[model samples]
Target: MSAHIHAQNKTTEMERNVLLIEEQGSFAVGGKRIVKDGNFDLTNPLQPDGQTYHGDHAYVFYQVPPKARKYPLFFLHGAGQSKKTWETTADGREGFQNIFLRKGFGVYLLDQPRRGEAGRSTVEETIKATPDEQFWFTQFRIGNYPDYFPNVQFPKDEASLAQFYRQMTPNTGAFDGKVITDAVSQLFDKIGEGILVTHSQGGGPGWFTAIKNDKVKAVVAYEPYSSFVFPEGELPEPIQSTGLFGALKGVEIPLSDFEKLTKIPIVVYYGDNIAKEPTQVWNKDHWRSGLEMARLWAKAVNKHGGDATVIHLPEIGIHGNTHFPFSDLNNREVADHLAAWLREKSLD
Candidate 1:
């Protein structure tokens, strides 16, 4: 189906899905029968029944119109964010969700386990307090101290900044990439095949998903920390060895397994000002370095008989976009290009 054919729909439909795995094995106090009150009550009231499932629930917003793309688009948000990041832009404009829906792709916006509505899991140990506004203000490239990224696209007014800060969900506990990977793998298995879209730290789980599951037809990764997958000197380690570096699940698969991705079409997008280092301000050189490594990885993928493309927005004259371009001022334009790329790949 042509991408252009999708806009004819006047309304979009959406469904919220919760994917969970039944908890197995014995709990500390569960299974022990205790006689309490006038009747028998299980030792653990939480699990009065035999077995309880850990809520490694992946909360997904599945949205689409009557006419949609053949492959669904799964969007994974970056660290310190929930699925809300994809629902609306920071400036209160429609986000990637609506853009892709209009273009006819069934969009699945995922709140990975432990974030947003997925809630905390029983297996998780502790939940960290949400950072202060200043932390996110600096971390998200909204500003460094009182200064913003040069020509930064993030809304600069006090009201807008406050609104942006509200979008942040508390940093839950440490995430088990294995759990997330398993959840994503299961979702893909249920859906059969679809395109994966990831941003920032989300790229970790995204990479693991694509490598382990053949159902991932393509990936549109927006700035996955390159060091996670293609680290310097030695190759990146397995998930079990590194824990969940970059918020991805650990798996038995080694970095060498990335070659399997040759069968999966992939595109990595980097935003503007990545190389900017203005004296005392925060140096964004890491972003540039990561993109460079991503470029090498893409080259290696192509060499190994797979196709991967790395795009630096500035190089294409699409500048002034922040790390979160999908929520930036040029979001629609960016989404349009992304849809175009999918259509070009014949996956739309």
Candidate 2:
């Protein structure tokens, strides 16, 4: 499909899907009735305007307290997941709603270009996976760490787990965080300065974009994909992947460049529960990049003054909470702490 047509074809699916309890129950999407024991993809997982990869973008809004007043915080889901990942109520944790709202932040969740309904095709092509092929999703890592770490059961509510697809979206595409940064800049202009928070993969681009815009005054990145550090001139292992080898070669946009761009106040939520030790690089190597990114962000902020802080949530535990941050069994506490932190930070 042509880019123009594809860009305009993004589909907005806001249905309240009912989830049937294992013994007996139902779920609904956007207030629509979901039959008991019946299964469906509650999140349409693709962008409505057809922009795939990190290509499509939009502004999501939630009003804060004070009778219709909006605080306008930006909410982002992790990779391989939609903004729904932030909204779906889990066993113990409240979604972003309770987490940010209770703290007085007006929520503005984002559907990153190819993620959710925005990213379907781009993600498939990136991994070179067949559209019908089952994306091998591993959730066993959850037991070892936090509940927000991709903790939900797949094919949930009686649907097939394979119903969800992986994104072929490149962590660093031609798309910069500028697109999102610009959107939030405007949102802040309208709603007043608010916290900008991101989960998992969304964390990477969030910094990329935040550094470029001044309006994004503060950040609460939950273990964003760190694209940092070279091993003493050797390439970071994740960049050496079957897919990333070429895309990352010859490209070394230092975090210093980001600092030069965005001097805004910010904070990073590192998943202390997770580790980036070289011994675990094969699969968990993504942290290498994440830490590197954090290092860069930290350096930039320190140079710019008391502009940012990187907080570690230990009770959240460090397991495989890479892509999702609020999923740990005790993530509600993490979120609560995060809310308290935001309450104290001044985005102005």
Candidate 2 lDDT, 41-91, residue by residue in tens: 447534243322233344353544332223457777665555666664434
Task: Write model 1 residue lDDT over 76-141, tens digit each, in one string.
Answer: 888878888888776788888777766667778788887777775645456556557775565455
Instruction: Give lDDT per model, in order.
Output: 0.69, 0.46
Clash numbers, per candidate: 6, 48
Model 1: residues with Cα > 4 Å off, grouped in runs: 1-51, 128-131, 226-256, 276-283
lDDT of 1 at 322: 76
| Candidate 1 pairs with clashing backbones | 23-53, 69-104, 177-249, 178-249, 239-250, 239-251
TM-score, predicted candidate 2 vs. hidden true structure: 0.58
Kindly report which residue stretches of model 2 are placed more than 4 angstroms away from their true locations once superposed.
1-55, 59-61, 67-70, 90-93, 114-186, 226-262, 304-306, 315-322, 346-348
Instruction: Estimate the lDDT of model 1.
Output: 0.69
Task: Provide the lDDT at 100 for model 2.
Answer: 50
TM-score of each: 0.78, 0.58
